[model samples]
Target: MARGSYGRGVTSTRTDRWLRLDGTTNTRDLGGLPTVDGGTTVRGRVLRSDNLQTLSEVDVRRLVEDLRLREVVDLRSTAEVLLEGRGPLRAVPGVRHRHFTLLPERGHHTDVFAVEEADAPELPAGWAESILPRQVAEDDQEETPAVRSYLGYLAHRPENVVAALRALAGDGSPDGGGATVVHCAAGKDRTGVVVAFALAVAGVPDEEIVADYALTAEVIDDLVAKLASSPTYAEDMQRRDVASHTPRAETMRRLLELLHERHGGPRGWLTVHGFGPGEQDALRARLRDQQPG
Candidate 1:
């Protein structure tokens, strides 16, 4: 596969994985990635993206008509949904939207997408302090804070994770059936974790999963800038440096390693969390292309 530089010393396989659109910079099809069994993922079966609040009508047509997007597995919090409303896709027929927020519901509205800097006053008190430190102390000392944060998503909300996986699996259909797009605010952290699990279940190698996660780094600046312009994410974006937000391969690599160490890998984690073998097979079948005889 041809490769290209995404700056910041990150180079990704240039397989036309990126889905260029007028609204978002980080949207890409999770297709053509090499799986463990020597088969590649089917194109258009699943997509990972940043926010869709600003998608143009043409963007909608491109996704809804051209891509045949059947479901949107939004990983945003209740506050985000309430603040962003449903966007234009809400009006589109035949498209289903499912919200399975990976954040623990705190009764009051919290900006779950916000950069949980220790001193960010705009964030609810004890937001980062409450969960992050504990997660870091419990996990491997070598794990990056980002890795710990990703684990926190699974630790705090296994039910949501299982639900999101079920949504991705969606009735095993050959011929690369209708697509499902998963997104959060910037499609880096929350979206990356969920998509990583799905791809892992599909038998994509750990390096491939890390590479796919790091692809977001290629457009990290664009994603941050776009979200920074929004009232919803502006404060959080301003609080953190852009470099800190770049999705490093090491971060995801450590995350996958931790999953392996703790839960016996994605399959093990899914099984423990109620996804079970039948559902796992469905998801694998949904995302994997049939190998030739």
Candidate 2:
């Protein structure tokens, strides 16, 4: 919700009003949020969106000039990069772009997820209590990517998450008064999780972060439709997308709950996840002010 007139498109869905790029998927800025403290997450300091694969001339102008975007962090895989075949970012004069597949090594996470996705979504929460567990057990362990992929996602704690954070944390601050935008293909699963951590570092409130996580889906409904039609679509993508939109509000609550139940809070979640002392403080300094606002 970056205030100051993000010119509404000719159409008028509350969702469509937020749409920035037609060809590019899941593009939206994380502005206008009132952080835990009094001040807001400085508008124009950060923008989040999808791939730059299909950025048009107008789209590039808006991104580089209007938004004054300094850097673009693309989280898509090498294979996806080859498939999509990107073009130059329209010579904005000063913008820089870099790619770092968040869950690096496509072999581990994506491979495991492809084998785990089931044909359909899980039963509604309350219904699962009665017989879904038994149904799932009988259906086969391979049918549940959330159980399998999430485990591998967590297991890669040894590699992926920590490495992704390091890359993000090390990126130089926004250049010459411009902001930075980070995104992956869909901008919901891996991108969402990592961006959530980034906002947390920036001192955004937990509620605001959750709201932001949900916001990407609202703005990029078309991408969801496209993914459904994608030739490579599979069960794991279905399961991951299912887990992604699962609760609307439920997933965020659950992540926060798990963090609280085990460690102290989001900070605790990072500590336990193997982000060492120096790394933790550096991230905090980047995201939070020394004095509590």
Candidate 3:
């Protein structure tokens, strides 16, 4: 599965640059997103994670120097920063850290993909069970707070999304144009949407962009397991299929379909968010198979 050998394929030439301790299980280098263009994202150039609050010393070393990540962006909400503290990025010396909150008032669900409990065929409509649909559902949010909030973020918060793209592309950073990463709580929905947009901008086909999108469920099976056993968890996953725990494949597919149907694919979506040709190009530069970095 992609989780086991994530960066291994690209790391033979490079080292474990983005590998970090204290980061969430879903955190990993986006360099593995295979492209028709031949190369993948350069290792250490960009990474995604829940929050760097608990990053260990080794994690710091990998991020600060090994990855040489020049920029660190916090896509979490303001409350999250207060609770989690993105922490002064010690690794990756002089790493220009920035905070661009995507969902400021609402606390982002950190582990929506923790599907271990979703193993239960009829999991209760608890907060824990809301991760996937809240993100990918096409229905309007009338009763479900999680669903409403997540969907509202997408429809109303184009600015944050745009800012995120600009940041990932380093629209105004000092990295001199290089690799970048984006993530929100689970690194599935918000992060996935952004990455798909970048990939679409890079001329990657929807089939592959979706392939990359579907991989997040596999990325965090362990966390879902943990959440399942803990009494703190809302429901028991009860051994259902793996895909059931994350956003339903059909749910995600429908969201992509909506993006295409409404905005004419990723580019049109970006344009609706006010992404001009220049910003679109910036996104392309960041995610498009690099010319050997």
Candidate 4:
């Protein structure tokens, strides 16, 4: 469907940036962002959303029939998916579902989406442990919990991180229509990191990327409430307030800074992790819009 043709709950905020669904608060098109070369990201090609387990029938229909969803890039851990089960979208025939757990496999599930796994194994030598509690105390706790959690994406699972980006870049889409919806438990961390890398590859400015990340702050309350209402996430959410899990614009800011300064930006990071020129071009093609006549 055309962008404006989306159903009633779709809000007018930020020029149709959000895909407001009754079941999800964080779903939105990763399109129309200004690129470095004076272009815009293609609309309806790439979407980012939260957990799809609670989607209503209407919501699923809208996503399938209207959005032309071609694939789903689920970044949740194995344990989380096993505990929560496949969501409403699992039954859709045309859409492809590819699961790539971004974190290490564990026997028990934790709120990995909201916070870093405290029991996660130590990083290999040379990977910064800036997010660990010991590092936090040594540094006077200068790093916010959110920033540490974001950094952990790099420290703990760089290989899976690269794979997740490849999956989003059309590796999982058979036809390359680009209507891929990527989500995790909260759709803000793993989703955010992968989306950030995708946007950076498309040459979207850091500010715009940060803006998109902060958009989650708009519906955080309702999003948290929805997750809390579900049996899968409610118990864990009760232990913490929504604000602690809320996305802050600054968190993304710091992440981008780290990406540029440490990993040499998205392209550098991807190249180091085994995504070559062909992979990069494919991702760019999926996100960038054609010039108008």
Winning candidate number (TM-score)? 1
Give, for candidate 1, the lowest lDDT window spanning 10 residues.
Answer: 1-10
Q: How close to the true structure is residue 42 of candidate 2, measured as C-alpha lDDT?
A: 42
TM-score of each: 0.85, 0.64, 0.67, 0.80
Q: Could you say which candidate leads in lDDT? A: 1
Q: For residues 1-293, write the lDDT of model 1, one tens digit per residue.
A: 11112224223346498999999999998888877666888888899999998999999999989999988889987666655656888788788888788876555433332333232224344333222233445435666778877887888888888988888887665443588999999998999999988888877777777888888888989999998998777888899999988989889887777678778888888899898878877888888854211
Q: List RMSD in Å for every model shown.
A: 6.6, 10.8, 9.7, 8.6
Tens digits of per-residue lDDT, candidate 3, 57-124, equal: 77666666666666666665443334333354633546765655555343343322122323323333
- Evaluate residue 133 in candidate 4 and report its C-alpha lDDT on the 0 to 100 scale: 34
The true-versus-predicted C-alpha distance at residue 240 of model 2, in Å, is: 11
Residues 111-162 of candidate 2 have per-residue lDDT tens digits of 2112322321232223212221222333235534433333334444334556
What's the ranking of the predictions by TM-score, best on top? 1, 4, 3, 2
| Model 1 stretches astray by more than 4 angstroms | 1-12, 108-137, 140-142, 175-177, 290-293
Error of 3 at 35 (Å): 3.7
Q: List the residue pairs that clash in candidate 1.
A: none
TM-score quality measure for candidate 3? 0.67
Q: Is candidate 2 or candidate 3 better by TM-score?
A: 3
Local distance difference test, each candidate: 0.77, 0.52, 0.54, 0.72
